[model samples]
Target: MKACIITIGNEILKGRTVNTNAAHIGKFLTSRGYEVERGITVKDNLDEIKWAIDESFGKYDIIVTSGGLGPTFDDMTVEGVSRALGLELVEDRETLEILSKRYKELSAELTPERLKLAYIPAGSHAIRNPVGAAPGIWISGGKSSILVLPGVPREMEAILDQADSLINKNDRFYYEATERLAGVMESAMAPIVNRIMEEHAGEVYVKTHPLKSETRNPEIDVEVSAYADSAEMAEQAVRDTIREILAEARRMGKK
Candidate 1:
């Protein structure tokens, strides 16, 4: 399955907060066999959020959004998503009950700000948050599914863990492999890598990372990753690319 991630917050845009949510979500989706297409961070503007949501619809099977689920004025993900989906914003009693119970357990009153957590787009279901007040929103779109999770890392992870059934039920797993070739320079191998990429085309990706080690000479790590319907096909594709690159490296006078 192809997926995209949108992180909504002005703090992230301003570099005031580290955007760890994208990396975490990317890793989670990758492990689930989802092909992550891209990750974007947008300000907490409803229009910008809605635009992103709309643009991603039909282009991806799943779109996950993090942040902007709090009770603060700048938390506008729900509103932006609702506008994008043409859904009316309404108070969900079930969510209200969940919030109310949690607050009562802590001997705190559910103030208006806290009550904001109870509102969601109509027809969407709330994914209970075991770690925080704002429950995640799960909305089924025309062609794509959306999961709006809280910005808090711990709470976001908890919600995702609880969503295994949904994610697995909708996605198909693909195989991917990575390899790092030592004692090579990326520039020297560029011609062969380019040829391999063109030869493989959509079947796989061959990338090079230049690295240095104090104890050894500068080297290039070549990572070959492929995605296919079957694990064997994916692994074999990567192995073939690795062999081809290594042969070219040897031909170019590498010992």
Candidate 2:
């Protein structure tokens, strides 16, 4: 399956935030054997968020969004999704009850701002947030499914973990293996990686990263990965690719 991630927040676009949520979500989806095709970052504007969602809809099998799910005025992810899908924003009583109970425990009142967190796009279900008050939104219909999560890193991760079943509905598997070389340069490893990719073709992918500057003390790490319908197939493909890379590195007289 293919996936697209949308990060919504002025903080991310303005460089005020590092946008680690996108990276986390990408890695998470990739590990589940989903091909992450694109990642988009938009400001807190509703139109921008809606545009991002509209563009990604039907183009990808899964759409995961992070941020703008707070109680503040800038938190408009839910509304944007609602407008994009032409769905009404309806208040979920269970979500409201959860928010109310959470705030009461903190000796805080469920003000209007806090109350807004309970509203989600019609026909969507709320995924409970284990770390925050705003529940994540899950919308499934048509050709794609959307998972809208909070901007906060911990809350987003927690809710994503809780919604794993929704994302990884199949038994597909992903496996990756890496080998570090002491004196190999990225440029030198590139050819070997290319050959391994050609040999494996669609079964595996190989990439090399330079751990140290090639002009100085050169070191490289080769990563081989595969996604397959079975865990054994994925593992075997990655292992075979790794072995080929190591053998080629040894032939180059580099440790």
Best by lDDT: 2
Write the residue-wise lDDT of candidate 2 on 37-83 in tens digits: 99999999999999999999999989999999888898899999999
For candidate 1, write residues 1-255 as lDDT tens digits. Answer: 889999999889999999999999998887777889988899999999999998998899889999999998989999999999889989988889988888999999999889999999998889889878899988875699999999999999999888767776533445555556566667777888898899889898888877776236757778888777766777788888788877888888872
Off by over 4 Å in 1: 169-171, 213-217
Residue 136's lDDT in candidate 2 = 92
State every prediction's TM-score relative to the real structure.
0.90, 0.94
* C-alpha lDDT of residue 194 in model 1: 91
lDDT of 2: 0.90
Clash pairs for candidate 2: none
User: What's the true lDDT of residue 133 in model 1?
Assistant: 86
